[model samples]
Target: MTEMLQFDFMRIALVMAVLIGLTAPAVGTFVVQRRLSLLGDGVGHIALTGIGLGLLTGSSPVLGALVVAVLGAVAIEVLRARSRSGADVALALLFYGGLAGGVILTNAQGGGSSLQSYLFGSISSVSASDLYVVAALAVVVLGIVAVFGRELFLLCQDEEVARAAGLPVRFLSVLIAVTAAVTVVIAMRAIGLLLVSALMIVPVAAAQQVTRGFRSTMLLAMGAGVLSAVSGLAASFEYDLPPGPSIVLLALALFLAAAAGGTVVRRRRARRAGEVVPGPAGPGERPRVDAEAEVISG
Candidate 1:
């Protein structure tokens, strides 16, 4: 523990944690809002294939990941346009195909470096160079989101409406796709490619379950993500476990906590309002069921 606090590598890892935690939720808010969460999973895995190709070519893994990540995003859009199965099926195909290709490439080279670390993650090994890349990527992602946030939100809420409002929805969609690719690439060093998508989606998913508005939800999700990243890294150090999976697990735990917390708050409010018992409906009233209870019962 003492070593972690004083060590430079640990500091870099922590910096990465903060950078990713902040921006991922911002991007993820759009992802979740648009119901495109699976894209994160697809792009992250595709990035692994890029890294494998990079290794084979002795190129920068970051660049390789970026190339494939963006390509995967574009491919998804294209596939969505051409197919009835839409984005989910496209995502599935890209994800598994990329993983299989990467594994084949790694195996062909006799598999010296275990790809599991890239799949699961190990933040303890983060270097200053990786931190630099992450910081740059975070800045770029945040900048794009900030400048075009309004349009992005409009598009996300209702693309046809955004188009009617003359918001250039197509351009914004492409911008988001590219930004997501870059974000995945930036995050790969800290969380690895396979599990990095969780960092993007889990916090936002949790926040949406509790928060009322888009802006508040995004902020809360970012906070949740940062907390998860830092605490998970700390726990990994203390337990001598893999950092990436630990961080993702921590984020998952936060999601569960937020859901439980939201439920408790709702019940408390209902009790305070003295609305626990149902009143008889008026003559015209049919029946109404609580959505939560229905989900639970089903």
Candidate 2:
């Protein structure tokens, strides 16, 4: 690690990774709670259009992506709130339209080759300016999370309940969407637009495997995200691999490990309680319903 950090680029990459690690999961906690796990991907797709626009206009791709992504996120939330039936259709349209626009714009600018880097990620290429932007955006994300964490949690747990409790549901919803958009843009350089959602989501899922409360899951998810990002960045450096995929794969591995461990712990608890632990469910059978209920109840 020390050897890797000796280079200026490596140091920048490391800082970017850590910042991304910390912020992605913070927003992801709410995303997962609302079961909108694919929201990041959708916003990322839109951000790609912004990137293409930046490249075509010879402007800053990050700034362009931020603008487009925030607008797209707000549009999505408004549409979702207004018409539940067409939400999926609206998202699909944005997803495909943004992707197509990005490809066309990028190719038009002869930036086709450069698009791959944004699509997958190239942490080594992260510049000092990019780091500054990422840091600023990350601070915004964390600040919003810190100040509105409980309200967001309530909003995610149940929108109806949140509304009944006199929370500003519409405003809070928009804020969450906008926050997620910023997070996607912040992570785009280090993690890539296509794979950024994995960083946002997988750690939270992994954390959920062992945690029972919202706060615990959020905290653990951030820890898991940081560990995955740092370790994956180091591994990629040592192995001459892609940093984005390596980080996402490591996060997935952690999820699998956590799932296995949680299962083992649950089974042991069940045994001590003299409950019968059933095996895998048969075809068309719902498995572990009783066991899950026991775990939840306990």
Report the number of the highest-lDDT candidate: 2
Per-residue CA lDDT of model 1 for 190-288, tens digit only, reads: 787888888889999889778878999999999998999888888888898888888899999998988999998777766754743445635455444
RMSD of each: 6.7, 7.1
TM-score of each: 0.86, 0.90
Candidate 2 Cα RMSD (Å): 7.1
Q: How far out, in Å, is residue 193 in model 1?
A: 1.7
Local accuracy of candidate 2 as per-residue lDDT tens digits, 79-115: 8889979888988999889989998888898887779
Worst 10 residues of 1 by lDDT: 287-296
RMSD of 1: 6.7
Off by over 4 Å in 1: 86-88, 110-112, 268-298
**CA lDDT for candidate 1:** 0.81
Instruction: Give Cα distance to truth, residue 34, candidate 2, Å.
Output: 0.5
Looking at model 1, residue 80 earns an lDDT score of 59
